[model samples]
Target: MDATSRHSKILDLLNSQERVEVEDLAARFGVSLQTIRTDLRDLSARGVLSRVHGGAVRVSSAANRAYADRRKQNATAKQTMAALLAEFIPDNCSLAINIGTSTEQAARSLENHRGLTVLSNNINIINLMMGGEAKELILVGGTVRQSDGAIIGEDAV
Candidate 1:
């Protein structure tokens, strides 16, 4: 298989198995150890995986992938949960939303709610609620996490 196809398969394996050793990848792909190492390096550089001493693991935990990947997973369920939560949030109330794909979805669902003061550390949520019906949108100041656009740090406290 071509390098692109091989890399894709490696990602698939990593997604399902969490981690893959260099020797195992080489054997599975019928490639040399050097080639497998190169693939791991490339994936790690792209922030798709984390290279370890003998193998590579998915960049994020088993329950969580990268932000973009997490956004695609359980999307329908997130929207449903967002809708349910939005219902409980009455108008003219203040809320602090945290970082996470589900929270971002919930913020989207709250776009039409009038007279809300939404405070958040998630840049995605702040952007989503901007110019909406909320009475105020407060973005907590802190260092922005490049991987997930989440504002986190001591300053955010």
Candidate 2:
């Protein structure tokens, strides 16, 4: 495809998926990795995307990226951090968690925990810890945002 078409396609992919790896984009477009990197750099300069090590992510604003995209972002890092956080959390304790992908990862890490009460405003977290060893799970009363499964009502706060 031409450069114009490639740029448009790249933006479309970023909008729907929130991230694109240089290798994948190169393979898809049948171009060199350097071409994709140059395109990403140009897009980044235009304030539409942000370049990372081997990929580019959609420019996140105060509103945040799509929920699915957020979950995929730095997932491995989140899992590692969550494991460390879990180590600090002793058993037989009441713990509260907030909404977001990192918090969800933390919840997964704490699944094997015993004698623990988990209170959260994230619907996903409530579901994730259900089959775990947590003694109790509490979900705050709020309006559930369907897009991200976040509870965001007055009662939640």
Number of the predicted model whose TM-score against the real structure is largest = 1
**Pairs that collide, model 1:** none
lDDT digits (tens) for residues 1-157 of candidate 1: 8889999999899868968999998999899999999999998888888999989988765334568998988899999999999999999999999999999999999988999998899999989998957479899999999998989999898
TM-score of each model, paired residue for residue: 0.64, 0.62
- Model 1 compared with the native: what TM-score? 0.64
User: What's the CA RMSD for each of the models?
Assistant: 7.3, 8.6
lDDT of 2 by residue, 2-75 (tens): 88899899999987896799999999999999999999888888888889999999888634578888889888
Q: How many clashes show up per model?
A: 0, 0
